[model samples]
Target: MRVVIIGAGLVGTSIAANLAADNDVIVVEDDPDRADQLQFDLDILSILGDGTSLATLQEAEVDDADMFIACTGDDRTNLVACGTAKTLGDPFTIARVKSAEYLRTWQRKHGAFGADHLVCSDLLTAENIVRVTGLPAAIDLDPFADGLVHMAEFEITADSPVASQTVAEADRFKSLTFAGLFRDGSVLIPGGETRIEAGDRAVVIGSPASVRGFSNDLNPSTTPDKADDIVIAGGSEIGYHTARLLEERESKSRLIERDETRARELAEELSGTVVMHQDATDVDFLSREHVDEADIVIATMPSDERNLLVAVLAKRLGVDRVIAVVNNDEYVTLFEEIGIDVAVNPRGVTAEEITRFSFESVAENLSVLENDQAEVLELELDSDSSMVGYTIRELDSELSGQFVVGALTRGGTLITPRGDTTLEAGDHVIIFVETSFADEIIARA
Candidate 1:
């Protein structure tokens, strides 16, 4: 695939890095230094010019692009670039915008910017926070197959039931499979004898009910005493989106904003939410409002430093979890080291989604787990597959260490593989493998 990306900032550069491994990528940046740095770091063609200009788009050869992405951190620039690219190439176009209103306008008017996809990093980041709110122990969680299937990651605690047990013995759930385990900085396709140890991150695939049970077992503290209360600092975009999503969960949520006008706007926009016009970092205001009782506190101030301080204060006020939306990637580790529960990078979140959509797959879906240590692929078997007529045992032998078949779907039914189960062509197969071996399975299945 030939991808032309119009930005060299964090999100665009990250997307380029992920795609350049298997695709021909061309990046255009007005800043010469960033473009040259990307060229030195990755095998990609770089154009040093303003991406919104027709000359720059022509110089980047938009006509040869299979996909054109505009993510220059400016909505006007991104929309103009996508419009220019679409006029020239008619390729699949994606524009990253900051405002939800612009995205709606694009969708309502047959793509107002000629962009096939509109990505709002703030909304994406907020949605990510909402997905994991009730999942305390989950390192990550993603759903597929119309919510029938789920891929989740859990960290093994020493006292957990699955911690000292082998893969075969960790059978708390009837409809779940341990897909892959990450330990000692290495990815492992666990077998029957692979013993799960403390600090190991285990990835699993299973039905929603089964995965939910396993998630609680992995982290017992997740079970809520009553309805969870949410306290959000700053009426930022992420704060508004998070509160809006938590409403569906029926949680009691509150938003604190220093600006009176924004507070009024948020109060009118969000129902069943308490909007407080005050400084969230102020101890007196937080104490007076009983912020300590919140189950989760999300810090979404404009600056990373302010968010970090808010998170620290929330923790000090007895909040169980503090999720910080950070702009600077370098501050992520620092936030974690200082005891923030979760540090989210809007760029990383958006980049992952864009990279996931950029793929051409024969499978139903592909989800990479644990920072690309492993990947879960949902594919269908065909007559050309090597394991078409083989039993589970034989198929396992054929796959060897490359991958593990996690589940099989025949017709509309799900099958947990046994040694004697025979796999036939046209059956749906879910396999989990080390990320390094994903392409091999993609080729065969």
Candidate 2:
């Protein structure tokens, strides 16, 4: 595949790096320094010019590109760049925007901005935040097969019940599959006898109930049913959306905003959320509200520094879980290191959302894990697929890539994968495998 990306910012650079390993990737950036740096770093063609310019699109050979992505920080620039790219070629155009208003408009009118798909960072981040709220101890979670299957990554703390358990012992859930483990800085494909140690991040895929059950097993005390007190700091778009989503789930939440006007606006818009007009970073205000007793605290302030401050405060106040929205990719590790349970990066979410579209028709849905070390893919099997007639164990032995069939859905019914289970045409198979073999496995499926 040939991909042409506009704006070499964090999202663009991530997309380019992800695709450069398996596809022909060309990046366009207005900053000469960034362009040169990316060209040298990724060994991909980087053109220094304005992405919204027709001349710049031509220089990047947009006419020959299979996919065109506009993911700059500025929303208008990204939209305009996608529109401009459409004039040159009919490449599958994707635009990343922060505003939900633009996404609504595009949804009302297909191809409104010449973009085949639109990824809203704020909304995506909010959805991510809400998804984890339902499963305690999950650092990341995504649904597949129309929510029939769930892939979740949980950090195994020293006190976690499953920290010292073997894969076979932890595989108590009937529908759950232990996909992989992240130890230190590397990815490990686990077996039945694999020992799960402290600090290892375990990845699992299964039904929603099974995943929720697994979460309870990991930390029996902090189950979702007992996680009632949810507090969100800051009334930014991400915060508002997160509260709104939690409300949709019939979960009443509290939102704290420093600005009186924004708090009023949010209060009026969200019926189920209690909006508090107070500084989230103020220790006195937090103590007054008994935030220490809260089950979860999410920091979604506009700036990374503010979010960090609020997250640190929440941790110090004895909050059970702290989730912070880090806009800068570089601050993700920093936030996590400071005891923040989860650091949600908007650009990282947007990049993952857009990169999945690059898979075209091969994968119905995709989730990148551990910074692209592995991926979970949902694929609809074709009649002529090489894997159609083989059982799970047979495919495992025949396939070149190391992968685990997590779950399958046939005719809207969920099926837990087993060694003797044979695959058939039209079944939606969700598999977790190393990133390098994703394309090959998809091709065979």
Candidate 3:
């Protein structure tokens, strides 16, 4: 597929890099320096021109492109670029929009602007925060279709009930199916005898009802805890976006801004949130405002130094959880080292979202990687395949190396197969294999 990406910043470059491996990609960037940087970093075509202009779209050959993505940080530019792409070509178009108001307005009016998809980074981040906060025990949660179905990651803690149970035995816990397990830096597609050991990170897929039931079975005492008091230190776009997200989740937040005019403007915009006109670095001011009582502290200020300082201070001040937005890649480890519960890089998060959305089939076709080398893939049984209607042990004859059929998805139901269990046509089977043997396994299966 031929893909044209506008804005060679982090998000655009990430999308280009990811798609370049399998598809033809061209990036259009306004900033000459950034465009040059991206061209130097990745093997993709770069066009230095304003993406919002019709001439730029024409110059980028949008008419022949299979996909056009507008990912500039500026909302107006992204929207105009997407509109121009739609006018210039019939290709699938996606726009990255940040404003909540714009999101609502765009959805209401001009709904058929020819943009195939609209990705709201603010909404994605907010949803992620809500999921993580709602289920503190879940290592990760990837929701599909606005929570219709979900893939959740949960670590097998010492307190987990199914720690030593086999795949078949643990299947009775709930109706959910175990997609894959990450253990010992390797992914394991467990069989009937495959045991669930402690320290294993298990990925499960199911509906909300089944997932909730499974979580309850895994940890009976687990409860949803809501953050009542939130302290946000920043008045930038990201900070404002975060505050709006928190308020939508029904959390009371206090936003600290050094600039009086900006603080007042934010205060007016976010009437429910408390806008504190003071420097976030002032520990005394934070203490005076009762930062001790905050359940969650979010530092999204522009400066990484100030964000790190405030995050560390919040951790010391007894905040339940601290999340800092670090723009620089170098500061990611520093934030973790300083005990910040979560460090979010908007660029990374946005890039991941775009990649995932773009490669919808890759998620199901590719295996879940525990490490960089090993992968666990779910393959569907073809009707004409030699392995169909054969038992697990019988099918082992054609396959090399140790392979296990972890779980089978047949007719939308998840089942843990035994050695005597037969693989039928149309059944999706999860298999674990080393990266070296991934191709062989897929081909043979």
Candidate 4:
């Protein structure tokens, strides 16, 4: 497949890097320095020109490209590029936007922007943040099969119940499967004898209830009951979305904004959430509001420095978990090293979401595992595809443990896979597959 990606930012560059190995990738970056650097570093072609320009599109050969993706920071630029590609070529169009308003416009009427898919970064970032709210020490979280199946990654601490146990021993959860483990910065496809070491990231696949239980058991310190008080600093889109989600759950949440007008607007938008127009970094204001009583503190401010400072201040005030929105991917590790419980990278998250559209099949939804080592895919079984009319126990040896079915949905009901469970046509199956064998699974599907 020949892919044309615009922006050459984190999202575009990453998609190019990932697809260059298997498909033809061309990147358009207006920044000459970044374009030159990418051209020198990557195997894909890079163009240093405005993406929305027709000449630039012609240079990138959009007419022959299989897919055109616009990921520039400007939503108008991305949409215009997609519309241009649509008007000029026969390629699939995808544009990344930060707001849902533009996406809604495209949805209300078909062919509005010539984009087949709209990837909203702010909404995706908010959804990701909300998923990790109650889960303990969850480095990543994804739901499949209509939320019946869950895939999550959590660190194994010394005190964790399954820290030192082998995969077989840790397979005590009735419906949970140990998908993989990350140790020494390498992904390990776990086997029966794969001993889980302390500090390793244990990835698991199971029903939502089972995964939630496992997370609580693995990190007993941050129990759901204890991790109740939620404090949100910054009235950004992410902050509003996070607080809105918590409002629906009836969670005790407080949002702080420095601007009076924005604070008033947030108060009107959010119900059951306390909105305060106070400087989050002011020691007196934070003390007056009992910052030490906060169990979770999320800093969603625009500035990285401000977010980091708020996170540090909240931690110093005895906040158990501090989540910071770090726009730069390089700052993710640094934020975690500096004691932030979780570092949310909107750019990286958006990049991963867009990249999955390329690898994920037409009938499948992809959820990447830790470090892109694997992906959990949910797809409906058709008569023409392989692996139909086979019971869980009847799977061939090569297809058995390498990938495990987490759950199945038939007739609007979810069924946790067992040895006796058989898959039929039209049944949606969620399976955990190693990244190395994704192509094989896709082939079978």
Candidate 5:
């Protein structure tokens, strides 16, 4: 596949880096330093010019590109670049936009703005926040097989019942598979004898019921119920969408906006939300509002620093979980290091969404994990697949790739992968594999 990505920003760079290994990647950047740096860092070709300019697109050979991604930070620039790319070539165009309005417009009319697919950063981040809230103990959660299967990452806290148990002992859930473990920045493909430690991040794939049951088993006290309170600090676009999405789930949230006008607008727009026009940083106001007693507190402040502060404050106030929206990619680690339960990065979310399209025809879905060290992919097997009709254990021994079949969905039923489980055609298998072996595994399967 030939990919031409514009902007060379965090999102564009991430996509290019992920694709450069398996596909021909060309990046167009307005900044010479960024373009040159990308070229130096990756094997991708870099074109230093305006992406929206026809001459620059020509220089990048966009006409021959199989995929054209416009991921500039600015919405107009991304849309314009995608529109320009359409005129140059029939490549699949993807645009990253900050506005939900653009996504809605594109959804209403496919191919609008010349973008075949549109990723809305704020909406994606908000959806991410809601997914985390659904599983408070999960560091990350993604659905597969049309929501029939769920892949979740959970930190095995010191108090967790399964913290000191072996993988075999921890495999109590009927429809859940312990996919992998992350410890000390390394990915571990665990075996039955593998012991789960306190700080190990365990990745599991299973049915929704099984995942939720596992979450409750890990953190029963923090699991939210229908009556639990969710407080959202800030009235930014992400915050508003978060509240709205929560409302859609029949979870009413209290939204704090320092700006009175915005608060009134939100209150008027969101019938289920309680909009409070007050500073989220005000400790006295938080105490009076009982924010400390909330089950979940989300910090979606405009700035990363403010969101960090709000998250820290929420934690100090004894909130069960604190999720913060991190605008800058560099701040994600810092936010998590300082004890925020989850740091949702919009750019990262957008990048992941757009990158999935690269395997749209091959893998049904893909989720990057541990900074690209591993990936969880969902694939539907056909009769032509080499491993069809073979037991998972047999296939594991036959294939050289480092991967584990986490879960399989057949006829809308979740099947926890076991050694004796037989691979069948039309089965949607979700596998956790080393990123290096992802493409090869997909091809072989």
Candidate 6:
């Protein structure tokens, strides 16, 4: 497919690099230096021009492109680029918008504009943080339909009640499907007699209500209380954004910063949260602040070494959860081995989001499932689509190993569809597919 990507920043270049291996990619950038850098880095076609200008887009031959993605850091520029692309081409357009207000108002006023999809980086990042931190016991979660349903990954600790129970005997997860179990780094598609042992990671899928119910059953005495006392060890953009998210959730958080002015500015912006002007690595200052009492400690300082030190200190100080934001992927396994509850690499997360968005079909948004083996894709049925008039059973038999119809959204209602259920035009089908076969499945559908 021919794809045109606007902006040559980190996000745009990352997305272009990921897609270039499989598609014809052209990156547009107004900055000559950045464009040259991206071209050199990724070996992709580069167009030096402003994305918001129609002439630049036309010069880039957007009309011949299969997809046009506006991913400039500036939200206004991205929106305008998307709008311009819609007017000039038949390509599926996507825009990256960071502000919540713009996303809320964008489609309501213009009805999808020329863009086929919208990516909200702030919301995505916030959601990713919440998924990892909100429930420390769960390793990951895949939210569907904006969080109404979820597929969650939980590690079986030695304390878990179902540690030694068989699938049938593990009454804890009654309504949820024990999708698969990972033990010794291999997946076991469990059967009724399959037994779960300690240290195994279980993948379960169900609605939020059912999944939470199952979690409660597994740990009956566990509290549903949200984290209140949070200690953030940086005031960078990502750190500030994370703190803002926590504050919005009514969580009490404090930012510890070495820079006095930046700390003061953050404190001003976040009136409810406390801001401390101190080095987060200072043991005396941390002790004075009672950092040990914090429910969670997040280290987002720019220096990876400092963040790692702070995380280790927080863990030693008895903080229930410690999360460090590190730039190096190589350090992720090392940090996890040392008991950091979570290590987030913003670049990796951002890259994953971009890759997921890049594969989105015009009729559906492609989301990566948390298990890392599959994807949850939503496909809108068109009148002439092959499966539109077919029953679920027929469709299942016709499709290959690539996909499985997980659920159907019809007339705004979600249904765990059965083989007898028939699909109709305009119905949205949620299919779980292996990434390797996603394109083939989509093409056939």
What local distance difference test score does each model get?
Answer: 0.82, 0.91, 0.73, 0.83, 0.90, 0.75
Q: lDDT by residue for model 4 over 1-445, one digit each (tens)?
A: 8999999888888777666767888999999999998888886689989999999999999999999999999999999999999877889899999987997898898567888899989888877887788674687888877777788888787778888888888776777877777788777778789898998988888887788778777776675743578899999988998899888777789999999999999999997899999999998899999987887889999888999999999999888778899998888889977768789999888988988788765446787665467777787888886778788767645473377677788887767688778789888887777777666666676
Query: Rank order by lDDT, top first?
Result: 2, 5, 4, 1, 6, 3
Question: In candidate 5, which residue ranges exceed 4 Å CA deviation?
Answer: none
RMSD of 3: 5.7
Pitting candidate 2 against candidate 5, the one with the higher lDDT is 2
Per-residue lDDT tens digits for candidate 6, residues 281-306, read: 99888898899988788898878899
Give candidate 1's TM-score.
Answer: 0.91
Candidate 1 lDDT by residue in tens digits, 278-374: 9999998899989998778889888898999999988888876788998988888799668787788888788777877776456677776655677
* Count of backbone collisions in candidate 6: 0
**Residue-pair clashes, model 5:** 0
Stretches of model 4 off by over 4 angstroms after superposition = 36-42, 225-227, 360-363, 389-405, 410-424
Model 3 Cα lDDT, one tens digit per residue, 1-445? 8899999887888678667766889999988998888888887789999998889889889999988888988888887888888887788888887776677776886544456777877666655655655554454565543344455667687768989988787766443567677887776666668899987877776666666666666766543445677788998777887788777778788999999999999999997889989998898987888897787788878899999999988877787577788877667767865667667776666776776667654334332333224444566677976678789888777677656554567777666566798989887776546656655665565
Task: Quote the positional error of residue 391 for candidate 4 in Å.
Answer: 6.9
Runs off by more than 4 Å, candidate 3: 30-43, 48-56, 111-116, 145-149, 153-224, 235-278, 360-445
**Candidate 5, run of 10 with poorest lDDT:** 219-228
Q: What's the TM for model 2?
A: 0.96
CA shift of 4, model 3, Å = 1.1
Q: After TM-score superposition, what is the CA distance of residue 170 in candidate 6 from its true location, in Å?
A: 4.1
Where does candidate 3 clash, by residue pair?
none
**Candidate with maximal lDDT:** 2
Instruction: Put down candidate 2 lDDT per residue, 101-187, tens digits, no spaces.
Output: 999999999799998889999999999999898886799999999999999999999998888899999889998999999999888
Number of residue pairs clashing in candidate 3, backbone atoms closer than 3 angstroms, sequence gap of 3 or more or interchain: 0
Candidate 4 has which clashing residue pairs, if any?
none
